[model samples]
Target: MADGSLARMGPEHREEAWQRLGSDTFDLVVIGGGVVGAGTALDAATRGLRVALVEARDLASGTSSRSSKLFHGGLRYLEQLEFSLVREALRERELMLTKIAPHLVKPVSFLYPLTHRFWERPYTAAGLLLYDTMGGARSVPGQKHLTRAGALRMVPALKRDALIGAIRYYDAQADDARHTLTVARTAAHYGAVVRTSTQVVDFLREADRVSGVRVRDVEDGRETEVNAQAVINCTGVWTDELQRLSGSRGRFRVRASKGVHIVVPRDRIVAETGLILRTEKSVLFVIPWRNHWIVGTTDTDWNLDLAHPAATRSDIDYLLEHVNQVLATPLTHDDIEGVYAGLRPLLAGESEETSKLSREHAVARVAPGLVAIAGGKYTTYRVMAADAVDAAAVDLSGRLQPSITDRVPLLGADGYYALVNQTDQLASRYGLHPYRVRHLLDRYGSLVHDVLAMAEGRPELLRPLPAAPDYLRVEVVYAASHEGALHLEDVLTRRTRISIEYPHRGVDCAEAAARLMGEVLGWDDATIAHEVEVYQARVQAERESQDQPDDQAADASRAAAPEARPNVSEPVR
Candidate 1:
């Protein structure tokens, strides 16, 4: 298949992919569609190796989509004296900001409030200074100190006695789900067969060596054997399970750590910049999303239901309690628009706290032809990918080329800045506001033209969704036709984030969005209704789960919802 044809992940492309999966022998098979798996596929494909990336559900349906959404060096890690990890992440952050994903990732400022008067200021300033210089390339502004009055003026939402002063620093943020999807698409563009709703059932072994994978189409239950020289397991939280399934003892264990975030209206917090407050266990961030303020997150050990990590009422209360300490007008549960919980696949350590576990990733050649990678932060997925592929090179024939992914730009990255300059022209051409054009550019980057082209004959698609005005109807169509969103929840929750961005949590727009997707995927009225029903039920289950008191109750509540991909089996223990 031509590279361009492979890049489009519509229904037609997915059908072609299934055929290819059954027939073609690839150099590498990536099991997981999170950022790391996608990045690994892209890296290997660019090195002129045939690759296939498979996911059990939608891309980024795991921890990749549920992160803090920042491309930052761990400022707190410096406090832990994890200087090398901090430096590496900062370098990756700079790459995303300037060279790699200029459109998807942009600079976001944060204010670190100083509670103690004298000692806190200089102490933070020193940390900030190290943060500013460590990344090497200065794409963002350096840190600046602010007085109590200055900080209050910048963020009037803060109480008068919340802080003595503040330090403002810059970090970058992106829509995590969109970024991960783009990475997968970029991999496809480079000739990797990227397919979601495809689960790896077992390993393919020849004698004592691993050879390939036996995969099942979670959507339809059709089974296929994909021949590959090496299989890299990038299944974040499910890492150990996959290792065990292969009957290979893993070099390290991965512990699940749950992190929760809540979204509120942007107007609720009168802040010009994001706020970072210290907690006894971890830090809480009040981040400025496009139309909302994203406040999170609690780091706690999670031992139940890794796939559906639930956020309980106690979790919500913990966030509200801490954030309210500094806010002039305290927020209640009623003010929350949405809440989400994700599990971090921490490399388990001697420390009892999940937060203290190592953020550095580990790549192991478990057998002759299989490699497993886990325990890395979202910001450093690319680096983690390179390392995994390098480790798997031992199984491949011939001399493999060194990874050149650092120099490879993702799809839509090439002309992003040029499109930014032509936003007004694009708006005029599309009969849209310049602001809407800019928003589309940030989300789709240089591919905004392709997105707008879909609405050419269909004028109605140009209009915004009535229930979720932030996104245009064309985007829902594009998600199915180009981005490989198979189900309604994939479009609503991951593709556009209408689920967490709106108070209705995408329930109100479910039908409209489903209809838009149905147009692209050829969904009948029955399929559309079924999709809508499942999405609504999922939302209700999440709401019920959030109201529960603890993780076990929350897990039970969340498990009540019908599975979007019912055929996808749970990980084998």
Candidate 2:
């Protein structure tokens, strides 16, 4: 089948989905459009089951979009003695790198700095040795020992006295938001009915079993009852709330652990390889992103708002203080381009510390027709999805085939490698610079042609946005027409990542992007102006919230701004 036919997911696709939601009974109805939910939809649909997926907001609007963007086996988990989790995650990482999403997931190298002399090198080396061979990490380079001079040469940003030596190893990374969206689109390609901006208000019960769901359209307030043989809940941080709606005493509890990451320009830190530093509570990562660096993550319990986890001044200071210890030139708040906070749905354990909670996921057959899976990291989303669908299989009629998602390439993965080889030719054909064409290939793969095709009649679309030159004008239009981007925030924040990558946090580009998206989404001047205004308010709120002292103050600061989609209510506590 042609790739374009794989469920357009644009405005028209969303309109058609409303008609189908109540028309037919599905074999499985999956709630949540995060990575695991999208993966579950793909897994069930691939097994020849009639499937449907519903998300309360846009795809990857929650934890899925706000990840650290690593596809690594938890190296820290190895020290925790959770070898099974590490091994499973490593296998999944390899699957994404080599088989599942070669277009999206790519290998990345990290330098583990050593402070002590004799014991540190050998100890870290031994652990890395096990990590390399555990799940066939042959696709990436193995560990290499480096002296202080060598390490400094690799990362000139590090303090000369910070590390006695270092060990460099390899892992993988991807655009988490894009990857999650691709999974949902790929599921649609395989005949699953997927709709976003649709929320499950309550569970449909047959006796004591959950038979389906009563869904409400967050956009127009339209309501529908979707009947299904079984329902799989993949709501990550919202797992407990969803469980309560099912009226089931869930098998496990989900604890919210908030993690915050700060983004700075790549020129701020002179590093060829990413850095992994050991902290008292947990390990910290200085991951390399395109033209920028992502320094992150404080593991603290989050009891406040779940939908918008605000990053406070203390949260930013905690990350800056820990990461600053190793830097030759310390990063100040002025140097930061963006700050984001995300909640990790950790499975509750005996330990009082949220950091000590389990990253391993648990799947349970909560009621007769309900299955809930929660508490896994991003790298193993496919495995978690497979397990969720497998639990739901008991209610399925016939003997279903095992998962074939391992063999099914996402929509753009098929001709990506070949297209990479033909970059110069593609550039020549499209009348774009070679570098620009290469960038499009990495982001869109074979779908780059579809995006560039939108610029054929209107040559102005090929030009870059005045404020955000890294992204072309056509991208904003294509995002609305093809990628299911419903608002200005969707394009700036996720579709192209202009929000986090820019200095003004997308304020300067908001009007231009809104205008571009308006042409495709058929928005009037008033609608475009409102979109631009809302985006500006969001950025202003985030900036003010980041300056606040604690979570409460930050949450209030953030809450002052109106949501782009107005009906997006607070998470049910």
Candidate 3:
């Protein structure tokens, strides 16, 4: 509540975390700091139980951050008649929009281009009517069937012959990495011991149950024993590897499917409405990201490095060719500003294909004290966490209560709606323009006051980073001081999004950002150099990898960056 500065998780916070979790005992230990894991920790902590959350890398560094950034009920799933998944996701969307994260998540509209005139309109309209009825979808207007003229009017960027008609509908979107970070920050606010860059190397077993995890501080390389009544694994794509860490065969295996997205300047695609163009393999989306468009996602089987999934030349070309079919101006390789790839964990079935697998998650009790959850979508993470907790509570050995997170608001949600009205006052107080203050409000809600207050002594901090003009210098400092951004990549890639937003991919600003962050993290000259070197190599690898023709070539190109200390971060399952 006190500005939510991550400074609380420093040496003192670390000392306190260890005193409780480091003391070899807790009521619950939740592994992995992705959204689901963060949610599980919060659910367990808020229910009057002691909890500890451990992440081998920065929080949300996996699929949670590198997502399509939507919070909508899966519309395509509706086509598949996955009514339950859509309804559940719609309910969560309502909570995030009106109750949970009003400041972070907002409504966004998409245009479904009708390739055929008559049948496509009615068929889509019938499905949308059902979509509108699913849950608490009242905040948005119902879908509207539109004429080709109406559709073209809504999306002026489209060529004349691109569509027969269109159906415009609404969905919600969020800054995924920031939302996940807020979840962890909110968990800590509720007294959960939260630590990142801490590895869960092994499970602590008693008789037949998992009692806790033997964790190693990847930063300091110190081993510590954390005892807990129950352990829940929310490692997503890395489920099988974590199960192996326990030396137990999992109830099922998790198959990794790779999806890649490219970011381009929004001006290249002139459209009033976001476009969802159907492709032979899947749907192609030209969704609006801040000052840019996010064109993505090629789904395919991946058996390579989970930590850094590389996108090859063919994948990029496929996206360009498909998206260019309707574009008035075509986007080329040079048009791309940022590119990212993520892996989804699908429960392996008899079908060896990853795309054919379902997104429904699995909860398994491999050991008496351990429960593992994997293979769910971003919107239903709360459900996955609740289910994981429900499964592990069997071993909790107490009169337990059902999950209350359904009715509970995340930390900023309580007063977020009211704060939206006070943007002018907040702007004046921070000595920034109302629009700038509004941007911060949308990003951090009441937490903007914390970021602003941190900059009170240095008014110069209100200005933008020279290299990454989209972010303030204070944001870099805040990432280190309050948002658990211990490393340069954490600040650029996750905390601030400078890595993908900038043309140089944050390589140019590495030193300047590092110098600013040094004030908070106490980094010396050598450490700064090391961080810069590592980050530069990473950018080089990613750039070189993107030029390769195949996944294997791309992956090899991306691996030139020297590995950090072994076991510094968990290879996302």
Candidate 4:
């Protein structure tokens, strides 16, 4: 293989991996393809270990893709006295912005509105002072206190009476799905056998020790037994279920907390900086996104569906009501372009409320050769991965290296700043706008050349999708050929985020995107038609589900749609 060349997760890669299944024993096998799991694979592989990561579905198809998209110390957690957690997260955030994945994660400013006239400014300022200084929180601006007039100037969408003052602080934001996918690709680049669309049917056991896994390829129903010395479980919300499959009672239980978010057009909220407001239970965020603003997040216990968390009409109404308390122009359901719900794997505690559960993660040697990790925020995924691999190292034979992932930049991270300086020149070289070239540089960094090279002979690939002008035709093809996008949902939902950004929820561009993906994946006319139909049905189902009044009804409405891959199913406990 080319040294450090791109690990193309195309059709050819999957076939070659399928043929090599169980060919040789691995040092460690990782279960789950979410952020932590992908991070664990990279950590182990970079330490010169033979690693294999198996995901039940596509990478970041779970909670990893559905975060608030911030890499910050939980500001509210300070109120709860989670100082250590906050400090650790801030260090990780600084690492992401400066050293690790600078291309994907960048600084974002948030305005925390103050309601009370007295005692609020100093109290809030002191907390923020600690937040900025703790754990060497560098790479972002320190907290800035703003007057009521200044706050309103920053965000005219906010009502004049909404705040007495405000404090603007910087935190890093990332496309969560893209970051997770890049982590998986980085692991594969380091010689880790990263395979998606594969499910662990059962744990291979020798006496009381866990040996390996019995995995089935979800594409064609073929099964294989892969041998490994150690197995690390990073299956976030599904941690309990997988531990049960291992015939071991988990040391800690993972309770699912459902958080729902709604995407509205950027013009709806006239804000230079994102807004953060206090709620009855937790804080509400109006996060700035490209051409859109993500306002979300209702937290409640989720027991209905882990695979597909549906946002009910009540969830939407709750968000609208809380946000409208401060908005000059209230947002209605009609203004919402997209809605999504994700489950956070919280460690079970004495509190009945999911919000009160601990964000701290725990690692347990669940069995002789199995190590399980669960319950941490998305911002601390690297630390969580290091802990999981550190636990797994006990079962490994050779001299293992400590996690050097803190020093290793992600796939598109290296030389990103240099390329950003040449955005104007790059735009001139390619037949594209300067704005478009800058956008590409931010998303792909140094890898923009590789994506642009695909359009070398075929200039048509450089053009944007007719329905979805924000993304190009080559991006769809690249998602299938380079990013591990095996289905249309993979491309639309996670790879490019067309599903959440588009007003039509990717339905308008479904056929076109499927057609582009089919060209790279070698799909027949029938396969292309089927993919389009499935995506359309999914969009229809999501729309219907969002209209439902409660989670039960919403879950039922959403579950009516069929999965993109027929054989892909959640692992049984």
What lDDT would each prediction earn against the true structure? 0.92, 0.90, 0.84, 0.90
Clash pairs (backbone) in predicted model 1: none
Model 3 CA deviation exceeding 4 Å by range: 1-7, 563-573
Q: Could you give candidate 2's per-residue lDDT for residues 1-573 as a string of tens digits?
A: 128456578888888888898998899999999999999999999999999999998899999999899999999898999999999999988888887888899999999999998998989888998999897367898899999999999999999999999999999999999999889989998899999889999899888778899999888899999999999999998999999887888999999999999999999999999999999999999999989999988899888878889999999999999999999999998999989999999999999899899899999999899999999999999999999999988887889789988888887888888899999999888888999987887777788888898899899999998788888999888889888889898899888888888898899989889998998888999999999999999999999999999988999999888888898665457
Q: How many residue pairs clash in each candidate?
A: 0, 0, 7, 0
Q: Could you tell which candidate, 2 or 3, scores higher by TM-score?
A: 2
- Quick one: RMSD of model 4? 1.4
TM-score of model 1 (CA atoms):
0.99
Candidate 4 per-residue lDDT, tens place, 1-573, comes to 122245788899888777666787998999999999999999999999999999989999999999999998988899999999999999899899998888899889999999887899999998998898895347778999999999999999999999988999988899999999989999998889889999998999999999999999988899999899999999999999899888987899999999999999999999999988889898899999988999988899998878889999999999999999999999998999999999999999999988889999999998889999999999999999999989987899978898899998988888888888888889899889989987776777777887888899999999998788988898888889888899999999999888999888898988888889999999999999999899999999999999999999999999999998778766564
The TM-score between candidate 4 and the true structure equals: 0.98
Best by lDDT: 1
Better of 2 and 3 by lDDT: 2
Model 3 poorest ten-residue lDDT run: 1-10
Q: What shift in Å separates residue 79 of candidate 3 from its native position after superposition?
A: 2.2
Candidate 1, 67-129: lDDT as tens digits: 999998989999999999999999999889887888899899999999997788888888889
lDDT of 2 at 286: 99
Minimum summed lDDT over a 10-residue window in model 1 is located at 1-10
**Candidate 4: global Cα-lDDT?**
0.90
Error of 2 at 292 (Å): 0.4
